[model samples]
Target: MQSSYLLTLLLFAVNAFAVSLPIRIVSWNVRFDADASTRQDGEKPWSTILCGIWSERCRKPHVIELLKNEAANTASPTIIGLQEVLDNQLEDIKGGLGSTWQHIGFGRDDGKKAGEYSPILYNTDALTLVFSEMKWLSPTPDEVSFGWGAGSRRVVTIGVFEHKATGKRFIHANTHLDNVSSEARSEGIKVVASRIKAVREQFGPLGATLTGDFNSEPNQDAYQTLEDMDFLTEVSKSEAVKIRNLDLTYTGFESEAGFSRIDFVWFGPTEQHFYAAQSWEVVNNVVDGVFISDHRLVVADLTAL
Candidate 1:
């Protein structure tokens, strides 16, 4: 009888722990130069690397399918923060994922005339957008310069969402730091940390998640700055979860040696509400020996804290 009582207490504890949270998040940086059709237009490559010849065949369907598969695999993320997506590309992603997601973002680089922008997509049924803003990472502020002396331009998009059912609020920030200039990357990290600090101070304690493709590796100064700021905890390092795809996410076409695990997802003080987090690279969508993007999708799951 004592053993039965102890077992019942343990089960109750597990159930109580599970009901404490109410949100899940997914974050990724889809490579900018994924479209082959744009190559023929004589436009400069969005990526830092050399973009090969354009393929006449469309890879959008395959790319969309992979995104859908990622979403389907998760326990229904309440919010998804994405970077490197074009204005029209969001439509494609929404179409692929069906009616469950609604998105918000602005063209931070010259009103969408050039360069890629970061965007956030959320499950409409789970969360409602309360506020959103876009800002540049360079000295020019509104200009399109790749602030970190990077070979490409980058921006950060932030969204505040309110849970429709629980009324709980959380902020999500998404960005792609400079890939070329070490200085720019460092400056970008500082900018992000400052902004998050300011947000928390003004808005009070709330759950927050920052997701993006930070270009630099884990041990780099850029990543270390953010870590020291107490702004976030790297989900990849969590003890409760074991995420796969630990190698290079950047696959250079058919090149076997090409890979870099530069993508990441992070959480702030309210992160304890989440139960799990992870990342994945869609390696199966290669077409004729070429990959859908140079980078893979990084995903994470959170319950609530």
Candidate 2:
């Protein structure tokens, strides 16, 4: 009789500890490392470049404000995966985000500070970083080099975090696959999948969320490669979730077309594990008729049950 009572008490205790936690994750491509002196096609010299600097500055404040709002509203700290970030832009964003925000990533060009970055940012007060890495999307992933006919040396940033309150850990990976090379996109995705699986295997039953600008549409092979993985599901397509602003992610100053829905947030571990998107949004990032980013932001309100 005493053993039965003890068993009942233990079950209750376990049930009490099984509380679900909500985490807000965002993925954005914030243009790139272009300054006022940069050049472009089909425009007067220094005209388009000067306008780009002004437009980016206008959008910077809005992006900072949105991050602050998200941090304030969520119980768990918000995780942001940013692509097309330059070293200067990263510092500027960190300053705007305040001291509590921390990030992990490196430039893909020289592996120091030459090229674009795919950085993952998180609030230090709500989470602790366990492990982080940056790898090139090439046949020789360990070194900074391009492969598979890639136009540039693309990279992926990954971080494993432990929730401060719940004692739960999860992996967050970020990347921007090559836009020009079809071979690079397909092979790059396979590498990402293998890396995600390897991380989970080493860490034990932990769920993972990968967010990025894949540069591929739903019908493309790169997108299909992800769907065939059988573990990852598009957060926007999840049942009971809301999808907003279902238009093109890349505006290219309204010149580019057919590149809709390239930015995405995918949730993995679809088995018995706890992962679901309650709501999703492709944030309308234009402010006062000026686009903040060439690529719109994608956000997901997720719950780990």
Best of the candidates, TM-score: 2
Return the lDDT, model 1, position 138: 77
Q: Which 10 successive residues of model 1 have the least lDDT summed?
A: 42-51
Clashing pairs in 1: 21-304, 148-184, 248-259, 248-260, 273-304, 273-305
**On residues 28-121, what C-alpha lDDT tens digit does candidate 2 reach at each position?**
9987756547623311221133444564435566566666676677676699999988887788788888898899999999888889999999
Per-candidate TM equals: 0.77, 0.86
RMSD of each: 8.5, 5.1
Against the unseen true structure, what C-alpha lDDT does each candidate score? 0.65, 0.78
Give the per-residue lDDT of model 1 (tens digit) for 1-305. 99999998778655543444545566666555544574533223333322234442444555666677766675545567777777666777787788978877666667563557688888777777887767778776556566856666667777777766556667788888887888888888777766665666676665678888888788886788787766578776664354553456555455444567677778866334433433333243355554565566666666555
